[model samples]
Target: MLKKSDMIAMALGVVLGAAATVPAFAAGGGGDPPPPPTCAKGQVYSAKKNACVKAERGALPDEEMTQYAYALAKQDRFQEALNMLDLLENPNTPKALNYRGFATRKLGHTEEGISYYLKSVALDPNYAQVREYLGEAYVIQGKLDLANSQLATIKTICGTGCEEYEDLARAIEDSKL
Candidate 1:
């Protein structure tokens, strides 16, 4: 009685339901709520170990390093963030590329940052945060149309009320003023 399409839909539903059970951190929604960014330049706060750890390559998980790098970029420590990002074993991940773009852009390399953001977006089109950063970069380059395109994508991914959408929206607004 069931068509092949119906069976495939049911299987997909089951897989998605299982994926929904994963913890937000494990699923890359922010990663264990990183500790305060008080670690030294060569160290990163490890949530699992509950303390700072040397940021040597392979010393910590790639995801943790990527998250810390993003945090460092937020603090305007662009070079330090890039150092940490370089330590990632798999640097091509969406989060890693997004952070790299963020740090690069902050360091005044807009084109390089846009390249990284494009790679991140290619890997994960639904990643709203990357879209937001990409939109901001477009704004910086005075490309309002490209920024608006990213804004529309973010609106579809997380709606206009989400932080990514709000941040990009604010950046676009501020650009026009």
Candidate 2:
């Protein structure tokens, strides 16, 4: 027979195991439903309706649009990402700027990307992801020192164990070769 403590431990383990399988984006907004699968161009996933919907200003919250733009960037749809970002009512947010920088950088305009990253950092200096991306842009420009500086800043915002730190560190290291 299982003791009460053992039963509780088993339940906790099950919950944690399920959580571990969840995609990272699921945590973007507190308890945001799992994002729907990728929608075609000019469409976006709507958590409210649990389906894809035509992308339009005011159709979804800015946060959701930003999340969708970020997803587009991750999928290598840089132009689509920028178009989605344009739909945001206010595109000056740190996350919006960061996504713009990411898409711009991936599109081979490193200088423009750096400018966006700087604006984002100015808005939210503690955003480690922006620091990482800024460092990467520096690496692309052969400015290892600047990249390293951003890496150090990222370390201060989030410890070396953070994904941003690890990714930037790897980018800096890879630049050396």
Candidate 3:
């Protein structure tokens, strides 16, 4: 079995990878026009490599673009995720902001990620996933109390058995070990 920490990370990775099909985000909509058909399409921002590479492009809808960005983030290509996210018209939309936060934190910009997550939560207090992520980000920063507070918020939002509540609770439990 994977170590608990690895499980948490893996669970998150799986969630990110599968997020493209996650319907909860679909309920929210973005109307941003896609970037021009050249280098901007499907290119991710890679801060660690300090580079961006052109990828396939087409007439993908705004939702697909966001999903593409989330997929890039799942592969650890966070900067690319950033690049993809920029093409979104509704960047401030809670779902978009949530993915932006995911890519930001994955790339080591913890505070920036937290800012995005906070913005997402502010936009929609019912965003359990964002709260869970914000809590995990707090844990990474060694702020257990703050994470616990987020966990409490998530509990209020989704009760104790939902994915967000369980994930944050597991992260907190793992942190204590």
Candidate 4:
């Protein structure tokens, strides 16, 4: 008889294989292709390739709620960004929460923004941009230790010369002022 650990490993392998094959068959039209994801405005249906195009133009949203929030944030209209964030189908999504947190922070709701930023980080710890913003928020609140920790993590994840790394570095430095 197989040992317990061996059985467990075999089960895990089967599950993983099934999971992998499901995606492959799904992509091959085993079912109808999923409906295209929508743009933030709800005015346009986005093809897969178009979902992240706006980021290339220095517009940060590029996908669903994020794009809407970015547009409002660009106008320095943080309340509107919050409103758009509220309208997202999946408000708990890290991207949505991150944008909302950023917008709220811009509007001077620092505590509320920090809460949302924390939520975003909890949802996706690997999201370097969210970590950067969380560090900025901590700095704004005079939480230097937390800010430094987050900044160090951002540096490690985003790479030394990346725009996010530079931005976080600047924010950290400015916070000391």
Candidate 5:
């Protein structure tokens, strides 16, 4: 009793319905697989081995860069730390800039050190340590006002008699004469 067009349309509807239902039935047996972890470019996932491998141009994380820079600085390898900072993809991270600045300061590169310190503070104004370092840098450069501003912030964050507080207080007193 059905017209040809109606039968054809009905057949197509059934086919489409089955097509949609088939995936639901197939998916019912097992829950969806966990999503793959995302990695930076130049990183590869080895499915057979179930591990991620770094490719030649892969970049390290900001935290790792800071740790490596600290290690190099501890070993008196300031230049190496600077080189590593230069290689980081996210070189502008506050920690990395702070480490680089600290290393440069230790190596007697005062201007470059202050530049990095300023950059670090600009990137993360809430970082108490960077503010302390900036204050110290200003003291070294004989800029009392700038140093006092930073020292006041450090004092507020660290409170009285903390190591940095004592140091900055002494520097401010010395700069007064």
Candidate 6:
């Protein structure tokens, strides 16, 4: 059985490794992946801090909404995540584009997904998360050379010890096995 923490890491899209083949149903009907974070009694979720801060009125800032969309995507709720992305004020922001790419790729729109990921990376060359995901996409497409390039880019951005570097490198290695 996959540990609950391992599943959480997968949900966060960090590094599921080859163990993800264990099957979701293998979880033995584990409950949903935590409610949409209610943020204590008075705080609100912050993507910057990834925790909660004093609640601000009006619509949620784009960063928080993007994080929420990612959570939705992690649960395999791709369409709902895309819907949330569409409603964002700056839908074209790099982070938003990355989530859109993630949802699109998971939905099997490979070429389109790569386009979105490319757009996001173009916007910010140092975006290691986007690079890791983009590398995964390349691996799925059987583009080993391209995937290696992304791993190198991640290494440059985050060094060899960063989670992004390690996860993407594992993905590239796993693709060969």
Each model's TM-score?
0.79, 0.85, 0.67, 0.63, 0.59, 0.68
Please give, for residues 35-132, the per-residue lDDT of candidate 1 as tens digits: 34548899988777888898889877897788788888878889999999999899999989999999999999999999999999999999999999
Rank list by TM-score: 2, 1, 6, 3, 4, 5
lDDT of 2 by residue, 1-177 (tens): 999999999999999988886766445432444444679999998888988999999878999999888888889999999999999999999999999999999999999999999999999999888999999999999999999999999889878978889889999988888
Q: After superposition, how far is residue 40 of candidate 6 from its true place, in Å?
A: 19
- Across residues 125-156, which tens digit of lDDT does each residue of candidate 5 receive? 86776777778888888898988898788778
Overall local distance difference test of candidate 1: 0.89
Q: Estimate the Cα RMSD of every predicted model relative to the unseen true structure.
A: 9.0, 3.7, 13.7, 12.4, 17.7, 12.5
- Cα deviation in Å at residue 3, candidate 4? 71
Candidate 5, run of 10 with poorest lDDT: 29-38
Off by over 4 Å in 4: 1-62
* Pairs that collide, model 1: none
Candidates 2 and 3, the one with greater lDDT: 2
**13-131 in candidate 3: lDDT tens per residue?**
99988896556444342233332222344564333344554443433546666766876776777888887788776678887899999999998999999999999999999988899
The number of the candidate with the highest lDDT is 2
Error of 5 at 172 (Å): 4.3
Regions of model 3 farther than 4 Å from truth: 1-58
Displacement of the residue 11 alpha carbon in candidate 2, Å: 7.5
TM-score computed on alpha carbons, candidate 4: 0.63
The residue pairs that clash in candidate 2, if any, are none
Model 5 RMSD in Å is 17.7
What does the lDDT read for residue 75 in candidate 2? 91
Which stretches of model 2 miss by more than 4 angstroms? 1-36
Better of 3 and 4 by TM-score: 3
Quote the positional error of residue 53 for candidate 3 in Å: 14
